[model samples]
Target: MVRNPGRRAALVDAAVEVLARDGARGLTFRAVDGAAGVPNGTASNYFVSRDDLLAQVAGQIHQRVAPDPEEVAAVMAAPPSRALVVELVEWINRRVAGDRTGYLAMLELRLEATRRPELQKELTRTIRAARDDDLRFHRESGLPGDATAVRLMYLAMTGLMLEQLTLPGVVPAEETQGLISALVDRAIGPEGAA
Candidate 1:
């Protein structure tokens, strides 16, 4: 096995590319090595096993990605408002655009995880933790129906993203934010949720 950090990084990167381009099934040592321009023996030497490679690839993806940063303030502020919606929609737009396959790839990974208990549990924990974070954010912000609405918010985004997957071109970011803004507007009413 290669003890050099640089070589290990190169192999992991190659594995990510393979997972992104051809998904898990296509992620083989020889192919990843070929894709990385590294020798087959070298790639195998670095990765050791296919499961090891997949775990590395999955961990790499998880470490790099974060929940939508649209609510940097809400994630950090109190009594969140319109800015939350604006930031969130912007985050989603940027997310989908930057990596069209990213969200889709997640869906694919999740479906595959159904047959793999460890993977399924890991994914479930990831999702549940995300939901918990959002719920806590809303509660701290004093958003009405903090619990219920917070839950709904997740559904809304998932539904919207699913729509995006199908239509791809529909729902401009501006319009999407506008819709959320309206909801927030209705929530705060004339009091202003500052």
Candidate 2:
């Protein structure tokens, strides 16, 4: 494969855009090259195959959608409480909503993974690791929830984001914040629990 990190990253990012806009079937080396504005065969040089490109895109989307360390630190500065958990969950929702393309690409990857065992395994590992990290952080940060609460929050937020991104009108924009607060309250317990 190509040893140039910057070029490889650019190609993978282009692939993300293609995947988000055109779905997995439209994600081809030429499409990525066109999206990246590189030579026609440039993507093939960077990725051994379409699956490799998909795997790299999966990793990139995770990084793109990950929480900023500074933002996490700022949130952590607050005393742990159910209210803080609600704030954290809302922040997460906002972050994902802001990166619509990346999240859409991630959704594409999930759909494509069903047909490819390797891709499925890779995504499973990637997502599970992220979930494990969230569980660890929730415990260490003294967040107002247990592992079960965190897990439930993940499920609820995933569903909420899916609906909001793919079918925005279903949730009604004005009610999103209220729903997020309720999700946190129900999953983590009452505001005064911790």
Candidate 3:
């Protein structure tokens, strides 16, 4: 395998675009090479196989959609409250929305996982670990919610994002922020407890 980190990262990113635009079946090494604007065999050099490329792309999408640390720090500077939770959820929604292609690529991975058991296991572990991290962060950050609240909020927000991204017209743009606020409030309760 190639040891060039920059080239590997580029290939992974290009694979993400191909996955997002063409779904799993279309995620060929040639497609990634063309998308990366590199030589035809460049992706093949970096990735051992199609599964390897898919795995790399999966990891890259998470990084691409992760929250900005600076933004998290700024938000944390405020006192923890239901309002803060609402703000955090809104930020998450915005982050995912901002990277439309990355999120779409992630969704494609989920669909692909249905046909590949190894990929399914990998995705399950990765997603569950991320959820656990979110739960820990919410508790430690003094955010207004317990684990259950956090879980509910996550589910609600995920559904909302799916509808918003996959079918834009389903949720009116004007109502998204308000809906996010409502999701936080309901999940955390009036007193911001579980």
TM-score of each: 0.70, 0.97, 0.95
Please count the clashing residue pairs in each candidate, in the order shown: 1, 0, 0
Q: List, residue by residue over 1-194, the lDDT tens digit for candidate 1.
A: 66888887777777666666777788789878887897667878877787677656655565445654554654545444556544554575567657655565565566667777877777778778877976786676655545665566567677777777657567665677666556545544423444
lDDT, residue 39, model 3? 88
lDDT on C-alpha atoms for all candidate structures? 0.65, 0.91, 0.88
Q: Show model 2 residue runs off by greater than 4 Å.
A: none
RMSD of each: 4.1, 1.1, 1.4
Could you tell which candidate, 1 or 2, scores higher by TM-score?
2
Where is the poorest 10-residue window by lDDT in model 1? 185-194
Model 3 per-residue lDDT tens digits across residues 1-194: 77999989988999999999999999999999999999899998988899999888877788888888898898899998888888888888888778989998999999999998988999988999999999999999877777998999989988888887799999987898998887877887765355
lDDT of 2: 0.91
**Rank ordering of all candidates by lDDT, starting from the highest:** 2, 3, 1
Deviation in Å, model 1, residue 16 alpha carbon = 2.9
